[model samples]
Target: MKLIKWLRNILNYRKFNCRRRALFSLKCCLVCKKPTKRGCNCLNGSIDKGTASLGPCLAIIAVLLILIVSFQYIIQIHPHLVRETSLSTAINVTGVFLWLFVSVLFNHQSCVWISPGYAPKCTDGYSSKYQNVPDEYFKYDPELKNDETVRYCKQCQTEKPWRAHHCRVCNRCILRMDHHCPWIWNCVGFRNQRYFYMFLFYLWVGTFFFIYFGYNRLFELYKVSSCILTFLPTIFCKLEENKIVVMNDNSLSWFNGRRYNDENQWFMFCYYACCGVNAVMLTFLMWNSFLLVNNQTTLESFQNLNAEMRKTRKNKKLRHFKYLYDLGSAQLNIQQVFGSKYYLALLPICYAPIGNGLLFPLRDQVHQIVFADTTNEPPNTKHLKVVTV
Candidate 1:
């Protein structure tokens, strides 16, 4: 009886030991639990580190090739195109190509460091650390009793840059962020704002050219169709000086002191088709042009402004000429928007002296003042305040 009792106890102990071992093995991490990996706590290194997939590269290359081919064909067919009407077109094509190239380069070279999933710690203008506030406002730092320099990120467990916001999708901080651009595969921040603007400018130009050319072609087609319907069987005949003359599709002839030619008919058909196509294309171009002049992207413009305002209790300001120029001067005109020192360098042409063009200093000055006032405040603070009116 004593031996049997002992044996039963032994069996129970062995089973317990085996269960404990299994539990311990399960808890073991597959990968190293480093702060760098954000406690991935993974055991196997199967998780990707930072490189972008080859698929994006391949897709970009394919798109670029297609654009190049299409551009080549268009240029070949329209070799007689003048720069005046096609200036926008030239800019747009060049801009798109540049964007594509930059996107590819950024995707390949940009780092993919992770940032906090929440905001960073900061002192208010009064030097009070808004600790215990929501993470959206500021992160908390246990060590930062009165030290303004000490900061903490709940998720990142690291210090964030001043004016940095954590991007969940990119899993990192963006500096002086304007926005993220999937087309460029990069953030349109202080560093990349120039490229973004340039891209928009070029796109607008290209769209304009395409519309002009297409409109002309459409008109030409319409004329040819009308002529064929109204003047059939005598399609190659023309009246001159009360005399009818018949001519082939390529030659001129005179009959009864009247002259007619195939060249005239051909010219009419070409002109009509060109005009018709251009008119149709012009409509689409005009819409895009409106968006550019307003300085709003298609996505930004489509957002439900009322809903956004209701949720945030803020009134969104439109990017208009007044907000784009410098306004400290006595001049009170709109030209400041374009002729301000900031934009002067960016203008393609310089026929007029700085601050002396149409709206000149006034436009630029107003925009600058508006931009300064707006920029001084927090991005969501002034803009989010709803007006009763």
Candidate 2:
């Protein structure tokens, strides 16, 4: 009886151990926990360290190849374009445009590679750190019954700072996030937003200049046989008043030999394709310009539209909507992107914006009402209350 009991006890212990090991293995994978492309850990909070989709990379490479081919054909058509005064102007314009475009493009790419920063983790007193922030940024949750003024990201298991949201693709919380742009293959957030704007500005200007300068080469190729005059078969055709005649070797060519195809048709096709890309770039450039002027992120712009739609639908009337952060001046808005120095805005180097990414500057008399605290004395001094160490 004792030998049978000992064997049964040993078997039960082994079964328990096996179950524990199986559960541990399940928890190890990111998919088991979150079931998304984003991995367990993200770099610099927002930088996606995981494998990227090949689609965006291939698309970018294709555009570059087309541009190179266009340049090659342009040179082939106009060998003396570098020396000719009119053509030289195109060369100079394209050269400078390409330089600036490449400079900002890589700079923006670096921004994407860099982390947008992570929200503070909730464990080991990290969650308590954000509680000291100003009332305007974080509201006191009365439901907690502890008067703790803080918010948390459930998925990240971390303390979420104001304006911080978790990006599922990257699997981390981004601060002051703009949007996830697959074109750049990264998230556009506070740190990289400046570089992004410069990239767009240069790309728009450069591509437009390219289209204008390269127009002659493409147009000349397409206009090779635009004016046509057909003669009747075995009939003597002539005009009375405006009698003019042009001779062609069509009859002789049929008897002899003929080259049916020419480079003109292919050049025309390439021109149309380039024009199509330029058109898309032009449209996006305008949209980005509108966003910069309005001091809004791509994500915020979409959110604002949705909110306005919902509001209008609910009220059954169209009403003028006001944005909270809009300082009501274009210069101020532009300053947020370009920084205070005028020259820095044009350069590709990194320049920090006026305020920290966390606490953004606001228009006068707006925050006083929005963050009115009953506990704090002296109602007018509420602005001073915003200074949270």
Candidate 3:
């Protein structure tokens, strides 16, 4: 009987040991207590280190290649094609390319590093953070108590402000989050939303400039080899004032320099790539332009669509769902994203948007819809009084 009891205890100990070992092998982070990715022990609270992925690296490489190749192409080829090697032309072309390149770089960097403002901890209550905000912004159905005036994020344990949403990827609640872009490897939110749009604008312009300037040389293979500089061993090649000569097929003659044909294929490839990229970017830019003019974020647009669909299904009378933040005027909406100095909105400088991400001035209709007593009947848009608290 003693031996059987001892054997049972030994078996239980082994089973417990096996379970502990299995859990340990999972390699959950000591800080966040979440399983690490491929044995990466992340001490930081967040699960993802955005830059570890391939998307951003490829994006950075693409930008660098475009800049380097465009610089060389314009300097070595454009002046010769125009038959004007003037110092002024060289300086002007270089200056324009540099400005575009710098702007794109700045925007890209800003998008990657800038935090998309996080929601503050709501340990006390809503009043602590939103003390100055107008009461209408927090109004909800009092009788139902279903739609709480303020939203609480369970993951971050913070009060979500008016436009705030919890980003599962970042493991924090973001204020006015537009979206998470893998190419930028960051969330586009209140702080870096301006940079996100500016990056698209600059990249579109850059690709356009590339395609426009390089169109003439696209089909002519001989001109491509001579006119376009390539990444190849050029120690044996002869260099004329406006051309490079490399021996191919035993053709040592300087004029017969189609040897770099294979290498120049990238030039043509880049040309068409830019053409396609420019077209897509134009479409994207235009979409963002429409969003900007209407005071909408990408996430908000989707949410609005969902809300509209739900409203349509429930009550046809409430078919039209107006975005509460839109201040009605297009200029005012535009000013919300870019600062009041509307003229400077075109520039790539990192200007702050009008208000903090927390609170926005509500439209009169918004006040009417919000502050009015909750009822089952459809909202009366016309006669409701706009009250301030």
Candidate 2, residue 389: Cα displacement in angstroms equals: 12
Off by over 4 Å in 1: 1-55, 58-70, 80-155, 159-163, 217-340, 344-389
* Model 3 spans > 4 angstroms off: 1-52, 55-59, 75-87, 123-149, 220-259, 306-319, 373-389
How accurate locally, in lDDT, is each candidate?
A: 0.35, 0.52, 0.61
RMSD of each: 20.7, 14.9, 13.1
Candidate achieving higher TM-score, 1 or 2: 2
The most accurate candidate by TM-score is: 3
Model 2 ranges with Cα > 4 A deviation? 1-52, 55-80, 83-91, 122-136, 140-151, 224-270, 306-321, 374-389
Model 3, global lDDT: 0.61
Count clashing pairs, candidate 3: 0
Per-residue lDDT of candidate 1, residues 1-389 (tens digit): 42354355445544544344434444553433533332232211112111112223443553464354335325432432334348666566556545544443332222111111123333331123432222322222111223333344445565543234444334455543445544444454423343344444443444344444444433322343223344331233332222234544343334422322343344344333334434543564465444335433333344322343223212123223222222333232112122234454243322222211111112333323323454343232221111110
**Which pairs, if any, clash in model 3?**
none
Writing each residue's lDDT as its tens digit, candidate 3 over 92-179 gives 7667877887888888877877777776666344445445554343333211123444566788775566677777655677878887
Distance from true location, Cα of 153 in model 1, Å: 4.6
